[model samples]
Target: MKGKVLSLGAAALLAGGALLLTGTANQSNAQDLLGVSFIDNVKPYLEFRPRYEYVDQEKTGKKDANALTIRTKIGVNIGTVLGVQGLSATLEAIDVSALIDQYDPQRTKYETVKDPANTRITQAYLAYKYSNFVFIAGRKYVAIDDHRFIGTVNWRQMPQSLGVVAVAGKPIQGLDFLLAGVYERKGIVDSLNKDWKMDKMPIVLDVNYQVVPQALRLKGFAYLLTDIHNTYGIKASGKIGLGNGVTVSYLGEYAKQTDPYQKDNVATKPDIDTDYYRLKVGASAMGFFGNVMYTYFGNAGGKDAGFSTPLATLHKFDGWADVMLSGAAKGFYYGMKEWCISAGYKNPVIGKLMIAYLKFDSDKDPGFGKSIGSEVDLLYAKKLTKRLSFLAKAAYYNADNGYCISECNNKEDALGKNDVTKYWLQLDYKY
Candidate 1:
């Protein structure tokens, strides 16, 4: 099915390119091909990333996993759409291939890496800009602030893209807004896995205002995932200057999740009434930084579910091990709370070095203990050249009392609570 869909898309794009060439044969402009003008300008880009990942689980009774993958993207940016002044378009495709495929893409037998070999059109969008507003239509990457709700999960070899029609603009000073209607979700996984859930369309609205130039900012957002769920939230952040080249930053956010408004009354969905909260404080001075954060996902037990950010870049928050990614849904049934602290340094020559520690626990104990686990994450990133970079990162998780309930008597690893360690080495290049 995905192959058929991709073929149709490729054919359409080829047809469009042919039409552009035909139009250029009849028109004339400054920049010409074979003494004939070809629209305005064409800019092409290429990117390549090769990564090696290793995963080890303490007590899964399965062998350790190793994966080597390469991701490549090729795209072109058209300046003007067939001589239209404010119209432009971009089209791109991506491919991911595996050399050592020992890990499972899905978390079944071996350790999961989730980087499967695949190829698809990653981005294809048309944009029209007038004044301060831009209108966009097509398949593209749509990311919200902080990526707490909706984002392009770039951590995966196959980033998530959306099919949307959106309008973004700034009508007043220090204020910006985006309104979009989403029809398709091309997630990091394959289409056969139900990753492209187009059953009911979703609507999104995001507004941000700068209350003070560099001191305070406010944001409000709404996401209505029809037949699934709905989320509404507000966030406030600020930065304070503290004397000699030092600054302190803080953030506070709160949100509510509830049952969504179904497009059709075919089948009733699970009831949901939960809350989400995040608080953070950080300080930076002389290329050194430190931060402390706490996040909460409320518990709605029984037949109801808790707050879950299904569209968010889940790997960024909670922990790098991604144990809490589904803990708030049904894996834990009691939701989760996390406390984290991190410190880092950055330099032009030394690049960036960061380390973080996180402690996780359930909001309410369900028979067993509330102790979920703790994790330590380390990262180092360096730019080797203007268009090349290197990165090394690792995560180690220690399950304090294991993540098991009364159901699993002696098999504590049944809930995937075994000690896990993962590391990666990668190089990225772009032209």
Candidate 2:
């Protein structure tokens, strides 16, 4: 699911560029642009990561079967620092497809979404930056350092999240602070068939202090999640650094949600209160880093004390094999608890190879009721040169019980779980 194209976004950038180059570029306060006289400044960026893979899906589901997949993205930046410091903007578009093989005449969205499905966007935005603060008003990426609790959701073929107006400050040499208000910004057009369930406004605050100069760092998060039907009290995270390229982090999140229109089936109970927390630790040094993490979510989002991170980040922590990306959230193994331990090895000459084993267990019931599963993944990533790179990946997921999500969780459709085994090769370039 990787490739690149300008789509119609370039047109808008060019139009905006003409406004800047002709109208504002001549401003006496502005700097020369490439020795070329212009109205506005224009810069383009391209991100392409295409993959070829073999996939096997459980035959129990008609739509779940073996196939191949491809992904791509393109972006442009227009506007200038001439008239005003905050007078600039950016544009981005992406395309995704899947099929039995390149030889197949038809392609699917994300190369995985069954039925004739695809996704497109005009992620455009304008922003102005001055001092330590910036204001963005468009569908741009919103990500923090580790992305454990909040992220831009960039790992998927159609990565999505929200737009935000954020302010940051550096009062001291080693300290930094941030405050932001998030707005619902996912591509709204593609989700019209169903009532697009979205949050109202989520507040995020973070602060980082450099304790031992560059040798150690500490960070804290207090995310206030609230919507019309639910309110997540607050979420927290702490990161610490130990000398010698080693770092550790922890998470303490709690929340509650109550919605009668929260599920597919009409027969579900409302969660008066669902509170849970997790204690996770991770380390990476030189050529090795592994993480042992766990989570406990209660009827927080729906299924009475279930473990799913609505505001939490499911992208950064997982093995990247995608076994737990979607369906993992719809399963019941979360009622009790879940954990994973993963590690990696780096070979400077070739690339970095990683392996991980993830297991989800539930005690609410057994044998076809609520169950546990295991997944194994091995992958390698390498940059062939400054602008080109490649990745090779393989994985296996064994669901020793009923459909991973159907029996254990209600949000099954979003997460496809039919015991899958897959392999893929991807090529990427930067421009």
Candidate 3:
């Protein structure tokens, strides 16, 4: 797999170089030597990232994971093709290779780490833009409304992309709108599950309105995953200046989920009737910032099935430990709730430093206990050069006694009698 990835990377580099040379050679003539128009706008980009991750869990006999991996992406964008205005195309390829395969990708027998070795076309799309509207078709990344319900999942090596037709525009002043119909979703586990082929139309709609410029914003969305579930939500967020160097920001969101078409067919699956809400407030001054947030996933009449964000960029929401990425309502009879507090500092000399603490609890009694666990996260990031950066991060999760018996459903669950710790060091370069 390593050799294959290296070979592909080399081939892509050569191809990109040839394209650059061809474009340069065609500058003399209005048309290229191959009879292609020289007017086409071309932009090429490359990215390389190498990361080392270590995971330690409490489960006995469960080996710890230490993984070293690299991710490479090469792509090009072509604009104004065929002398047509508002027409463009993009093609990109991605490769993730393992340097030391000490972790399980769910497809292997080692300890799980989620990141896998794979190669695939991450993005290929055609787009047209006219006036204030843009239309896109093909496979691409999608994210909506803070990514609480939908996102590209870019934190992972593979990320996630969707096959869809999408449209976006500012139809009116202070208002922006987006709509998409997804036919398939290629997830981070594409190499393991292939793409999730939707049997029905999965439609998404998002709208945002600037009520008071930068001081206030209102947003709404509706995501319908046919034959699966539908989500409708609204959000309000804003920032206010408080004289001096201090500023205050607040966000509130509410969403409801319901069963999709053919609700009766899947009798074994719990009915989809739940609600999700989040509230956040923050203050920033000088180089310091602090925030407090609370999130709730309402129980559906005490059923184990709670609010689920099947399409969300889970890692970003729940703690960085990724314990609740699958939805906090998993094992408990009631839903799940979380509270988080975070603070950060930034300076030219030290880059940026951040720390966060999170507490998890069950919304209702589950016989054993209501407290689930707590996690602490720390991160440091520095930009070494124009196209290079370094990052070091860590997460420590301490489980309550009840966490292991209830929330720990899989062998990979970090929740156990003892604490779980994970560390990562990464370097990134983009051009």
Candidate 4:
């Protein structure tokens, strides 16, 4: 596999130069012979990304997906450790390569650039902290809240990790808390399906407070995915500052889904009731920003099931032309609903700009028809220095005709009248 990822990137650059020369030659008796504080509390991490992606679809002559990819990540982090004062440790690795794979990482059929080159071990953890607690176990990267249900999809090119055990705490003032336990997951195509992992023993809970710190916040969550589903949620976010330089922001959310231990599966007969909602409002000043959003999933638990997240980060929610990322399906009925409007601007000499508009529909009523399409997204970013960066992106969808009667029934005359386009270009570097 590419020479075992170049021999683990030459053993992580020789273990970061032997932890920076053993912490600068034992900066003084190596903490009384390694009781910890080794190698000056090590830290070394790097990242590189190169991407080019393009895809066009409307079915018909089928053949449009161009990809060129590269992603690499390496890591190290160690703190206190051995002497164990709130110990810590971390290790990371990731590699995805393809210099032109012409798209299809739907895991198999060899080359369709779903960015699948592979080399894993995304993160290894061990953590501990006192005074307001913290603890973690192995395998890492997890996101809650904004990730929508759980995340770490890191925008693809291999980013999904889990095998958790976690904890977090904050005993007072502006509360905060978290708890987690997961068995395994490791998908972003688990480098081409090792059955795409997933072993389930899920459990998660999160809580947040911060009443007015950043201008208000509140949150709550629950996951629990053992015999399949369970999701719970609440959220409220805020920001407000209105005076010449305007600022206003808001977010609202709610969630519900059921069927966990109350299980019943005749091998895939799922119907985990549902409900989900989201709302957003925004404003910013000088460097401009704007937003309007709405989302709803709900399917009242009919056609098999509907509200789902399957580990979010679903291409940052609905419109990236990922076609509702599992929401608007029409075989066993799925649900989808969305609306978005965004605008942005940031300029340090003309650097960032963004625009978004999306719309999609269908939330039960699957006898086909609920206009499911409309999208337009664009972005540009720049920062070419101090760690390098540049990016350009695009997406266009446009499907409607009720998205070919809810997604091409019987191939809808050979793939429902096309209309989906995408493009991306990127470069990033970090250390």
Preferred candidate (TM-score higher): 1 or 4 = 1
Over 4 Å off, model 4? 1-84, 104-128, 135-140, 145-147, 154-156, 160-167, 170-205, 208-295, 298-311, 315-321, 326-431
For candidate 2, lDDT tens digit of each residue in 1-431?
A: 32223443444455345443455534433346434333356667766655565556674423433444445565667666445645677777766655444221243322243212254554666777777666666566666665555565565555655666677778778788777766654632244122222343556677777776544566665555443133333444555778787776555545443442233323453443444556667777887878777765443333443434444345455444455554333323335455777788776677898887776655455344455467788889988899998888887887655333333434243233457776767787888
lDDT of 3 by residue, 173-206 (tens): 9999999988777888864223334455578999
> For model 2, what is the C-alpha lDDT against the true structure?
0.55
Per-prediction count of colliding residue pairs?
A: 0, 23, 1, 7
- Per-candidate TM-score against the hidden true structure: 0.88, 0.72, 0.89, 0.36
**lDDT measured at residue 292 in model 4 versus the true structure, 0 to 100:** 92
On TM-score, the stronger of 2 and 3 is: 3
Which has the greatest lDDT? 1
lDDT of 4 by residue, 52-158 (tens): 98887764465787788888888878775656778777878888888787777633433234567888877878889988888898888898767877889798878
Candidate 2 ranges beyond 4 A from true positions = 1-6, 15-39, 61-70, 78-82, 97-119, 171-178, 187-189, 192-202, 205-272, 283-286, 299-305, 311-336, 366-370, 402-417
Write down the RMSD of all candidates, one decimal each: 4.5, 6.2, 3.7, 22.1
TM-score of 4: 0.36
lDDT of 3 at 391: 94
**Poorest 10 consecutive residues by lDDT, candidate 2:** 108-117
